[model samples]
Target: MSAERYEYVPHHLLRRRVRDIASGVEGELMAVINENVSDSPLREHWVELAHIRGASGREFTTAAANVVPA
Candidate 1:
């Protein structure tokens, strides 16, 4: 089976208020972590947030695709 393909378009979400679509939670976007694959053309984006409502921790990471401006 072939792997799923993704475009490497990075979003500028730093210090912006964003909401997670899947969880419907909002928070201030703290960081964007990019992982470049050596054998693939796509890069993975992970986002970290601070001051998240209804969350147990102070920060968490989620896929960049799951977040949008709040």
Candidate 2:
């Protein structure tokens, strides 16, 4: 697709905020895909990253479009 403008990635959970250790910039965040049942330290902090589009307040997945995954 055109680049998931906004998407929710499931995170396991974390003891403290990991904004410093993970990759990316100071204000930026990253997500890791976990195929196995194991968990990552990052997962413990972020339950889901609410990716926000521009200032339009219009998310990529609307109420109807969110019925199923693309």
Top candidate, metric lDDT: 1
The clash number for model 2 is 5
Best by TM-score: 1
* Error of model 2, residue 44, in angstroms: 28
Candidate 2 structure quality by residue, lDDT tens digits, 1-70: 2222334445432222223222221221223222222255333322233222223433321122112111
Q: After superposition, how far is residue 3 of candidate 2 from its true place, in Å?
A: 7.4
The candidate 2 region of ten consecutive residues with least summed lDDT is: 61-70
For candidate 1, list the clashing residue pairs, or say none.
Answer: none
Off by over 4 Å in 1: 1-10, 35-57
lDDT of 2: 0.27
What's the C-alpha lDDT at position 67 in model 1? 77
Tens-digit lDDT track of model 1 for 1-70: 1253333433576677788787888787766555333454454443332333334437765677787889
Q: Candidate 2 — which residues are off by over 4 angstroms?
A: 1-4, 14-19, 22-70
